[model samples]
Target: MPARPDRQSLPYRDCVGIAVFNQQGDVFIGRRKAEGDPEQSAELGAPWQMPQGGIDKGEDPLKAALRELHEETSISAVSLLAEAPEWIYYDLPDDALGIALKGKYRGQRQRWFAFAFTGKDDDIDVLNPGGGKHPAEFDAWRWEKLGRLPSLIVPFKRDAYDKVVEAFADIPRRFNLG
Candidate 1:
């Protein structure tokens, strides 16, 4: 996908992901684990993905993404952009990561925002201090090189992540030297 010349308007249309970048220029990635995801048939047991959620009516994707990051990872280092933003899209795989969704939604179309993590790695907490259910799309995680994240993600989303990585190639140098 070439760069989108038009920016997304309000109501974002669908979901967005928070690409929480750190001082090392790495982005945060999380996992999901729900009742065995029996509904999933694709690589059902493979670890995949990061913090992402649907953008609500009248709600911005960045807000939703940050909320999801906190809800899923208990971190607030993420921050959205005002003008330029990193956006990407994808189609649902025939079986989706080799796991079946057991639902009607085809797949998520996303607008991802990149953030510089000014906090420490120990600050990331998916379980949170209160201990509630993590609204996750992954079960476990580790900071990865932004360029490499796409291939590690489900094959279905590799293209989308590739687009995002391309759009934000300079992301690492943004605030990484502190």
Candidate 2:
């Protein structure tokens, strides 16, 4: 199999995105499936979230952001209605994440991008990870109201997701999309 452009490098710190809405006002959320969080998935008995992942050495943050979004959520960058300019970051707790990444930057610097879902939830393909090693990034998916999402995500990721959600609030608000 060929490697995706996002996988051209290794161990880069870049995973982030803005969860956006579909035409009907539902927010897109990709459940990280069972692979990303064994403990969380087993514990909560639920799995889903916004698509996100690390960046390649030379990839632009937006490129990386869009890449992750598709690889995880199956939503292409072309589907995005708005993408953020500046990058936002968050550190992983000592108890979470790989050891190599834990001690260094503490967290990754991420650029968040927003999309307008052009297709329905059935369009998302969590099992088809494209160039990804794991076939599951999301087990189930759906679009919720943007206002309620910050609370729906896992606690550890909530803060980071919340920051981007808050920072990008103007997208739907300004456009009055939802």
Candidate 3:
């Protein structure tokens, strides 16, 4: 057989993910609004995911996480609980190999944050993110048991979600928020 292509040669995009946990320890998840994505295949399942987005140029990861949270869900009322010590990476599936992330990355290297939701549910306004520089990503959202995160995201991203769950698992007990 010929040599396989080296996926590691490609760079991973720097990104931030937020795990917003309610007082009861449930984390926030959002349903992806299906759109025409030339990068992804139709076979993928598990449209639900936590709030996440790219880290802009020279922007701090925590700042990016907050911005992503607000832009995607209009949620700004949160108290920083913890941050993952290591950045985790996830690779795009075969169908998304070349087109995902604008073909600039093999996958994403994400720094995740754990935040305690400090506001009421009414504070979340997914439909209209104020000012509208970025379009809405989730059509619906809900609080879910944190353990279910790995099974609720796209397959290619499951490992990262698992790591996120593991990294932030102690927050509830450590902070006695639950």
- 1-178 in candidate 2: lDDT tens per residue? 3322222232336666656577665677766545555335455534556677777878876677667777776665346566666677665544443432533344566777777766656666767765454466677777776667768766655677677767667776665676
Instruction: Evaluate model 1: give its TM-score.
Output: 0.75
Q: What is the C-alpha RMSD of each candidate to the true structure, in Å?
A: 7.5, 7.4, 3.0
Question: Against the true structure, candidate 2 has what lDDT?
Answer: 0.63
TM-scores for every candidate against the unseen true structure: 0.75, 0.73, 0.91
Give the candidate order by descending TM-score: 3, 1, 2
Better of 1 and 2 by TM-score: 1
Residue pairs clashing, model 3: none
Local accuracy of candidate 3 as per-residue lDDT tens digits, 32-89? 7768653334578878899888999999999999999999998999999999999999
lDDT digits (tens) for residues 29-85 of candidate 1: 765565556433345344457677777789876677777677777777555532125
What is the alpha-carbon lDDT for the whole of candidate 1? 0.62
In candidate 3, stretches whose alpha carbon ends up further than 4 angstroms from where it belongs are 1-6, 38-41, 131-133
* Residue 87, model 1, lDDT: 52
| lDDT order of candidates, top first | 3, 2, 1
Best by lDDT: 3
